[model samples]
Target: MIDKVIEIEPLDDLDFGKVTAELRSKRREQDTIVLFHPSDSCQENLHHFIAGAKKIHGSMFDYGVNWDDLIWDIRGFESTTSLKDLTHASNVLFTQDNGKGPKIKVSRKDEVPFAEPFATFAKAFVTHRHNEKPKSHSNHMVAIKALRLLYQELPNSLTPCVSQLLPEHFNKAISCAMGTQAKPTLYVTGVHLTAIAESLDEYRLTATPMTWKNPIPRNYKHGGASQNRGGKEAKKERAKQLPKTDLLLFLAALWGTYEEIEERDKALVCMSIILLLCGFRMDEFIGLDLNCIPSREEYDKLPLEIDPETGTLARILRIRVLAKKKGHWDEKIVPHCTVDTIYIAVERLKALSKPQRLTAQIMLEEGKWNRFLEFDDDDYLTSREVKEHLGFPGASATNTISTLALHGIQRDPSSLKRKTRFRVGDIHDGFCDRYRERISPIINGFGHDELIIPIWEFLTLRYLNQYTPKERLNVFAEPL
Candidate 1:
């Protein structure tokens, strides 16, 4: 066959295009392991593929020998390199081929890996020189099937050379070919092989004679000493609860010009106080509105009517709260005399009636709402914002408290502003002046209905319920 060029009709002489056209073309969109079959392979096997296109019927009539009729396993496999060498080797073997015999090919030195183990290397060497006859037809099919199954479970990370698969890997593959119906799925098996190959590669790269062991540990630890060496480990855990004093300094520096940035300053001060003391989620403040407060008259009204039964503050101011509960936002009201910090801030804003401070109208605009307060267009300040403001995140109440510590905000059982202890009446006066005295009577009057809103409903509608203590403390105790 090497000296004589046969002039016979090419295989295309037969009108097989129509039959081959019926076979599906196979191509890969990704590099991952997958199965492959020639375009004219069996229609039955095509339909049998787990994820094959459903349009092809497996039960269709089977006929003809065509490229499409050939199927091979290709999962986790790569094509062999140096095809030109193999073609030359095959041609040399074909020189002695008779009309009735199978063609032979010259085997290249590189193709020795394809031959079975224990085969004579000398015989293989000569085969490459003269080009030996092709192996029996049955042996060729078996080899093709073996190659297909091997690739399906082969790890992509492994070198493309077949010699890379270790003895254990080869054994497992052979078992897989003969294994039961419970065999691993294509993905699982392929992943396992890939993982093993990668681990081996990593091990090989790091292996050294000085650190080598015959049987390595199953569970290896990295950076073993550094993990437990530091005293800072314990401190790191406690840092979560410890207050962040630096935050207060940062905030003071940023918003010190309250007059220049009125609305934002007020919002920040109020939000910081609420978050620090109440431990409420930041979004809770996002929903607050003017109706969240009670009027000055109401604060002075006194819930208990002097019945002459007992001379007491008559018709005392009763505070109401709406809060979310049991998966439902609900309304709850209670009578109270002392005023809360939130009430004080609102009252101050009202009393100051400063044009710079945020008002009902200004806070409503989506774009303008965040002007004073630094926030994204979405109106949400992320934990990172809090961390950047302070040294840590703001999501936690504890963090908020520490942030205020630097600003002279004393934290303990009592409510105090720096060194000054506030009385219930003081808080009350503060609330009324900001809310009732300054707010137009018409506006204050209009807010009455809103004050009665259930805490849950209020919360849902952008209103918050700040908690108050049973009695207002007149002084701060340093140690007692």
Candidate 2:
């Protein structure tokens, strides 16, 4: 593998190819052997592993996809499966169908055994959840957090099993939950806990028995008088769940003011406009694919209609939106206008960043990020040169690019304390920015009326998307 990336090696005068060959000897003969990774403890950790599998991406991973055996270890231990592994990873990831999710922090401290009941129960509950269909990883994390919080509120003496949990324990945990999550979130957390508690007496994971009764109301949404008791302040908060008017008007003005903005900032302007148009969750935006929209031919197949009021050509473009975190589902949008606005913005944005996307494609295929397309690998470049290559010139650009290591090589092999030299191939974690074809402030384009762009597909194009009802989208959201 040609994977050794030198950070900075200066290029000086050389007359011909022969001259270059003449001085091709080692700059210093006192070199030592180095390994690719200095500190990873790999498969050697296999012995300490009790039994678990790496959470690999599944073939049956999408919405309506069949249950594949490889999707997870449904036996209920995949998330925290690395219990006894000797690898240096200090965290355990949440179980995910595709390979993206948050990780829970792990410690070798006493908390490990103390929290075992919660972790153990979480593994079972989540496994049971998968039996129906994969729950969103965000929801899974919330369930785990709920359990962890409940465990924390318990007395110091270690609870032997989940069945030992009591009513007072739940009350203390609900108090903690109220502080961190809203009523809806609290409700879901309560549901998961109740599910396990209800089943624990009969279907105990062990000989341990469950005697705890849930305090949370099953009718939480409408049980406002009983469950929602923060007095006037709580009522004020619930009344104001929608976004404030002044902030919203300021955002809406941005859509009309698009043409007046600077050319360099066109992409983000279009993005904010799309976000206003489509209520996307942040993760969904990042995982958007290039072919998110159907072909003109496919789109034409949808029932056609003309805009009678506008007296202009109108069509409902059935935009293909990727919900990366949430499983894909169909949504009905109302009176979304102007295919011209969305189609043009998407195409133009795609055009601008096509080069970066192609480069990313190469990076993905080769599993390497060694060199820029036109730059010499042996030549050294400064931060200024790199900044210029990326386009954009100013104090702000210099300030940002100056801090980049940009694939620079360090002087000391044993220590990262040494200064780094910049090279053309020194791109940072640029490849990790998903669904983006172009790089910059993303891409430049204009939008109008409505366009539901995915959050991640085009760094230029992504936005957090959800199956928002048309009414709430018009009302806007409260300050996040």
Residue-pair clashes per candidate: 38, 26
Q: Tell me the TM-score of each prediction against the true structure.
A: 0.22, 0.49
What is the RMSD, in Å, between candidate 1 and the native fold over all Cα? 30.5
- Least accurate 10 contiguous residues by lDDT in model 1: 471-480
- lDDT by residue (tens digit), candidate 1, 1-480: 479887866777855654333321221133333233323323322222322221122211111212122121111111111111111111112011121312333334322222221112112222221122223223233333334344444354333323244535444654664452122333233333343333223222111111111121122122333344356874585576666889867655544554565543555565565455444443333333345556767656546565333455454332232231221233222223324554665554443333322323333222132222343332323323333443443345455444334323333335344332223232223332333222222221111233432111222221112112311211110000
Candidate 2 C-alpha lDDT tens digits along 345-416: 566566544544544445444423433556554455554455455444473444434334332332223322
Query: Distance from true position, residue 466, model 2, in Å?
Result: 25
RMSD of 2: 24.9
Model 2, runs deviating above 4 Å: 1-133, 149-159, 166-186, 205-213, 218-253, 256-259, 263-265, 278-288, 295-315, 323-326, 329-336, 351-359, 366-371, 378-480
